[model samples]
Each structure stands twice: as C-alpha cells, then as structure tokens.
Target: MFHTESDVVFVKGLTVEAVIGVYAWERAITQPLLIDIALETDISRAAISDNVNDALNYKAVCDDVSAWCQAIKAQLLEHLAGQIADKLLAKYSCHKITLSVAKPTASSKRIRLGCRSRVMQRSSKISQL
Candidate 1:
C-alpha cells in the first residue's frame, strides 16, 4: 500500500527547445523554454528500502518532458504547461504536480514570461509537503 504522506521531488532550470509561440516568425524555429516541475508523492518506502521502484525517477520524467515538448507545437504557454502536467500525472505515481514553463526571451530580452499549472488527482488526497 502507498503511504499517505506527501513528499515532493523537484527538477529546476531544465531548458529545452520547442516549437512554441504565438507569432508566425516565432513559430518558424525552435525557442528555449525553461521548465520547472514538482511532483508530490510518498517516498517513505523508497527512503526506507533504498529502492528506485519506490520513488519517482526524475531523469525519466525529464526525458519524457523534453521529448514531448520537442514534438509538440503550442501557441500558448498555458497549453504547453497543462499538457506536461497531464502527461506526468497519467504516467507517474504522484498524486499532485506543479509545473512552471517559461519563455525566457518571450516578452523582452531580459524578461522571462510564462505560466504555471498545478493539478491534483481527485482519487488521491494530497497532503502538504
């Protein structure tokens, strides 16, 4: 049985190139996107048993997100972020997830603008991490 306690695993500053944009010129080529993800899970069993199966494999998650992002074209950051959340929620063992997708060069040369999306499965009650 899975534990009820919520533990968060995060990956930050993961930059990937994707075909995401609103303008025609922007969509002509790939742009850099910075993705941050937090997944809420119960890692007590993994911590105790020191088994990889008991915990989320962040590398696999990163690879999946990177591949998916590269393959999709989105006109809005919200849509892209939401897709990532949905994919992870369906594929991983986490009850809740928080994702931030940023286009570091979207608005201005120095300004980073994007969206954040969070999703939780209703079947599982998520605890504060």
Candidate 2:
C-alpha cells in the first residue's frame, strides 16, 4: 500500500446531539455525540500559497457532517459512522480519512450504549495500455 503525508488536519470534540441506539429507551431521547476526524492530504500547495482555497476547509467539512447527521437519524452508531465516512469520501478528494464518534457515557443502567468507528482510504493508480 502507498502512503502520503497530510497536513495533520483534524476536528476534535465536535459535539452534536442525535438519537442512536438499539434499545427502546435509547431511541426515546437524543444524546450528546463527540466526533473526531482526521484527513490525509498533501497540503504543501496551501502552505506555500498561504491561501485557504488550497487547503481542505475543515469548517466546511464540519458543517456538512452536522447537516447530514441532523437530516438523517440513525439507530446504531456503526451506521452513523459509515454514513459520515461515505459522505466525506464522496464530498472531499483526499488520500485517507479517519472518523470516530462516541457517546461519552452510554454504559449506564439508564443508557447502555457505546460505539466508535474508524476508516482509512488509499489512492490507487493503474497502468493504461
């Protein structure tokens, strides 16, 4: 596999509220969500040019994620994570990305839920005859 160095872009502790779980009680109310995302891309151009356009605008990414989450409610954390990963891949052109979503305190007798997910993407090149 090939690897590329990104500009170390990340979004930490982005809090949001969503309904996610597998139990009846879990679905009854919304819960706080913490999201962390890391993107891998060559940011040299942006660094050299000193232009925001040349870099991956993290705010845009966050807005997109928030909107998508608000629009589509998921019953499981796995599904929610997958949705975010897929959306980022489709919306952004990057070599790799990792996303994690956590419920903080979902293990209580009242809550009883916890989930996290991570994904990575790689670039591929093929020889044309």
- lDDT tens digits, residue span 1-129, model 1: 565577899999999999999899988999999999999987888889888888789899999999989987888998888778988988998889999999997876688898999888523332222
Q: CA lDDT of each candidate?
A: 0.88, 0.74
Give RMSD to native, each candidate.
5.6, 6.4
Q: Give the TM-score of candidate 2.
A: 0.78
lDDT of 2: 0.74
Identify the runs in model 1 with alpha carbons over 4 angstroms from their true place: 1-5, 122-129
Clashing residue pairs found in predicted model 2: 106-113
Predicted structure with the largest TM-score when compared to the true one: 1
Residue range 13-111, candidate 2, lDDT tens digits: 888887777788877888887888887767788778899899898889989988777666787777788778777877887656777888876766655
